[model samples]
Target chain A: MPPFDLKDRAAIAGAGASAYGRRLMRSAIDLAADAIAAALDDAGLARERLDGMIVTFGSPIGADADTLAQVLNLKLRAYNQTWAHGRFTASAIQWAALMVAGGMADYVACLASVSFSGLRRPMMGGAGNSEGAREAGGSHGEDPVFGMTSPGAGAALVARRYFERFGATSAQLAAIPVAFRKHAALNSAAIMREPFSAGDHQASRFVCEPLHLLDYCLINDGAACVIVTSAERARDLRKPPVHIAGMQPLPAGREEFIWAYPGFGVAQQSVFDYDAGAPPVYKMAGVGPRDIDALFTYDAFSILAWMALERFGFCKPGEAAGFTQDGRIELGGALPMNVNGGLLSEAHIMGWNHQVEIVRQLRGECGPRQVAGAEVIQWANAYGDSLIYHR
Target chain B: MAANQDDYAKPRPAISALNRPYWDALRRRELVLQRCGECGMRWYPAAPLCPRCWSRRIEWTPASGRGRVNSWVVFHQSYFRGFDAEIPYNVAEVELEEGPRLLTNLIGVGAGEIRAGMEVEVVFDDAAADLTLAKFRPRRGAA
Candidate 1:
């Protein structure tokens, strides 16, 4: 029997996005139509050739994969989706790769189309917040009973703990968002590209204390799509195939908190000295943290960036507060991160935007913000899911 | 004085069969957590069995009503209409001595003064006729 590894087994053929804005005034399906069309066009693949789809979020948040297939008039052989969660972006892509690799589908469209504009009420943290309604409480430490609503508040809990445990301050945490915004300034499609300073981050009002308004990701509406197929299929397509070199699925248990790494201890997790110790994704890719040309993450909140850095062993726990500082995570730095402006300034496409950027960056499509000679990039997250890609 | 009792529009716990006993004890002005009779493991938000050992033997026993502030946050935005008046209210995650952490309000202290590891004791807040919530206040001396 031959040894098997998923390394370079699948590849992203093409990527695309719809206009991102606070009030796109378009429906989720409408945004998805553009993204799907654009991705198919980017890959130079006809609409009829697309066979599978995996949507990260559906229904109340965006268009379902089933609906996208119907409305977009796509011929699909397989499709899947998860609930309304931005964290599942990596999960959807991984599944799409598996579907294409296993011959379950030839070309799988992995994407999320979210049009939050013109809603009756805010879906995130106000009275309409549905996260707290879960029976076992929300996954993000959202307990409506104590007014602990919104995903950002849960992140605030983690930020406060990190500050106390690591002697970090809100001023230091500013670097993460600041760097992402700087990257956004280079992109033409980003929504919040004005580029603010740490002082502005400090001056911003605390939506939840210790987490200023800047700390939160924008709630604008938009969509992004990626086309996945086997490495052989991707090579035959238009653009250079960004190979799926490694994959690590999300983790759970008592030690898991959506916002913090284990032992950094937010919820029921026991506090201990967390050691990154070369996690699997790095080993699977046959590369270390140093091999990554640029890094991307689900920056739903600024604190999550630090958590992702520490969780992926980029830096030790309690060290991201410093590791993220002094232009380290910005373009031209040692290890640029979230170079597509991330979810922070790039329309919160539920991390679909980051994936699009990764694909384009690997293809050298990003004009100014592209990492020079970017051959490898990793999408690691605070929630412990990751995917490593290469040109 | 039950301040929250005046207008309890704030979000309340959903008391299901699994967690109703914990809430019932709170309404009785007692703080209790489920202790695994087999493993002696204590926890909050009630489970059918021990999370550690999955023991079917479980009991609701009184907690020490003592804890330390593991973490806390102040809200400048109102997420709930009931909490609108208390715009800058604080939610403190107090780690009870029994080993489970609870999301509760930190009372009798300014949000600015709250700190992780600050000793706290529970205050049974009768928010409404049939509802009581566990809140926390700094422990100045031994109970």
Candidate 2:
């Protein structure tokens, strides 16, 4: 295997997000079209210029590349859709970049859109009938006869183990949402702008034990999209292009459905396996975590932030709680993590919004939420795809 | 509650040819795992080929029915309607002595008392008529 180098072949020219709220009162296709249009507009490119596109497989109403193409009325030379769930966003950007770099397409649009409120079947619906759900319920093999059906429950299990191993408290985990909420206060598009406190987070209801309601990501209905094109072409565009400095997927051979039961030990072991050295993302990107100016880690749940911090080498094992303590992750703090509030307070666009925030921050477009002199940004999704961006 | 009188119309496993033997053994109150005869590798949730060596020489081997809790979660809400009655139940992952991990519930223990590394043994629950499910309980005389 030759060394991978994606230093500056492609860049993100523009990013756009639709209105995020409880119910958008729009079809998934419409929301996707809205985001794509805004992205094209932001890039000063016409719809006809896009020759390739990527959409989320979980799009509400089963919207795929063809559906989005027809909705946007574009004739594309190449297009694809990803079914990897939340992990596909960064990979989608990478694939789109490769297309542009290889001259397969001049410009490509990577999009993720979902309307949970408008869907007949929500994200976790049809639990008992689906094969995956049945497997989760311990109907097969030696699984527990009744396993957790929600991802939040599984995340809670991981959180409990982390707390037990590290002696971390709920009060420490509460800092994540509190800091993001503070950042959300500056984001006009954020869903939860109310000032958050540790007391408030502790007092919030427990969706699953050890994970408070505030610890979970919001389920607001929205979409976000970004336009990727060759760096040379992007330099001539309307906006400052955010270069794709490095991108890589999660390490292979890890277990799936990690949260439903305990063997979470195996997953943690996989992470610890990399403790002796840097993760593949940093190695592939040719930069360390310290090189990042802003961090936009997937925050589907608050515990994930701590996990990413440790897994990505931002801190040592069991030190995330202390590392993030004292507002280190706040807007003006050392790391400036999830400055757009992330999925916890921002709209849940399946981590696509994080990419948008990274682009905006790298462009110095984020007014109040911008990190001072921010030149490099990094975004990692739940499925382990990590990407670093530079101004 | 009577075993046959409970409202147990929950979702049952869509048993297939590959996994039928495992389910059949569970119905008979015996724990079994698939072992690759060629590579001597054992696994759970039966598949046709060995994941390690891709060998077709597989055999059903009786397990020790003993393991330790790797981790667990207490579901505060039910994802399926059939489980609505069993809210706040415990689900655990057990690593058997035979080197396979199975998802099962921890019985005879409070949700708060469950811990990693706790010793547990397999027990069968007839969740529905003719649909026996395997679960785990704390090992007797073991902490």
Candidate 3:
């Protein structure tokens, strides 16, 4: 796939997110509705105007995309719930933008939510029926049977591989949570906003090997949505449309299984596979990594954020630890990744808060935690599974 | 005193139209997954259309079961009640010889025994009733 630039094709007119943290009283459906309404309110666009709806897959809730569209009374041309592995949050929005550009719909509402607070039981068992969906297992379905069900375990394998390949240590990986919590200290909305030190992260009890409790993402209930429309229509809206300067997703590629130890012989799934959509976003936006005013990448796990930076060409693969160690990713540095405190401190709303942060940065609205005089912003997500979505 | 043997057991996940092939293939101890005949895309949680090509021409193929060790972790914590006996076990990302990478457990090796780029062969652990879990053992000289 050849890379192309989306100079001024689609724009994000409005974005919204529900309050982060535990909300056991709220059902997942209510949370989705709340988030959808919040986004429409932000865009100053009526709910009736929404013609398209895109949702996420793997959400514990059984509400399908069509069901949500009907309940919201969203009379639209297309409605699809994308595979829900965090990274696609922004990718789903990009898909909505493409649909609108292609005339499939005029206005699209992209929604994602999670009910982590209510998940008292360990995440295991089959992924019951949904749209075109089979239970999430490998070729064998053995892991599910053996109770290896949490995203944490799957991610831990990646983290271990990362360290093994790069010769990094557990202490180095600890720097990711340390940096995020430091930034979270300035974010009032962040769940674990207290300042943390390297010592603090190392001292936290181990949740999985080479991964201490701090290395994991927070399990909280939350939802987020964004409204997208054609750039021309956005001009007449209530708010100054945040132009969708560029959108990029992984290129489609063939897979060859290498299920051995550190399977690097074949690229199972990496940024290399992403369909070359908009040029490296920074270039298409007429900015470079250093010029990025504010940055937001999915923080389902801090390692994801670190890997994204490396893949985006901000730092060399193994050099991310050193760059993070120097406080470059924190506020007042060259770039402030996740200004709204990412999923780690903020609500783990399927990485929707990351999107909220990008809009807030472009609008210059984040208060004490805000980066000063922010102009261009970047938002990216890496799904827990093989699917990679970048926009 | 032990009560009736099966009283407390959780019911098995029912096999339906969507997953019959996957369950049947597993019961036969052959790992099968769908691949796009047009785009050559492989998928788990099999679906009809290729996510990349949008082609409904997907074929189910058995995997080679030989892969390199892409990544791994030694888990010191247990979450699922069924995983209680698996404390300190190794979870691995095996890049199958067939060209797909998956999350599975590695057995027949100690924590220090596993390393990046090591060749591993799939071995079945049929602990659960009617289920054969895919586990891996280190290829000799892989260390």
User: Which one is best on DockQ?
Assistant: 1
* Prediction 1 TM-score vs. true: 0.97
The regions of model 2 sitting more than 4 angstroms off are A1-4, A59-62, A125-145, A254-264, A267-276, B1-7
Best by TM-score: 1
Ranking by TM-score: 1, 2, 3
Candidate 3 segments exceeding 4 Å error: A1-5, A57-59, A62-64, A118-142, A145-147, A252-283, A383-391, B1-70, B93-109, B117-143
What is the alpha-carbon lDDT of model 1 when measured against the actual structure? 0.90
Clash pairs (backbone) in predicted model 2: A143-B103, A143-B104, A144-B103, A144-B104, A144-B105, A154-A259, A262-B71
lDDT string, candidate 1, A212-231, tens digits: 99999999888899999999
Q: Which digits, one per residue and each the tens of the lDDT, describe model 3 over residues B1-143?
A: 13432432322333567657766777678777788989887765557677688898888888777778887766677544455666777777777766666667777778787887789987765544565556677766644
Please give, for residues A1-391, the per-residue lDDT of candidate 2 as tens digits.
Answer: 4455678778999899888888777887877888888999999998899889988644444357887777668989988887635656777888898888778889898988877778665454235223244432322122223645556766776787788767899999999999999999999989888887999999998777888889988977788899999899999999988898788765444243332111235322222233515667677667888888889987888988887777667877678899999988997788989999999998788888888888888878889888999988888643456888888
DockQ, in order, for the candidates? 0.78, 0.45, 0.33
Clashes of 2: 7
Worst 10 residues of 2 chain B by lDDT: B1-10
Residue pairs in candidate 1 whose N, alpha carbon or C atoms collide under 3 angstroms: none
Question: What is the Cα-based lDDT of residue A126 in candidate 2?
Answer: 34
Give the Cα error of residue B129 in candidate 1, in Å. Answer: 0.8
Over A1-391, each residue of candidate 3 has an lDDT whose tens digit, in order, gives 3364356678878888776676555666777888888888988899888888888743564245777776767787887886645546766777877888788988887777777555554343323212112354432123544444455655565567668767877787776777677777887777788878888888988776667888888877777877878888888887788877755654322332212111222235541322222235645556566666766776766677766666566666566667777677788877777766677776677767777767766777778877888877777544311111123
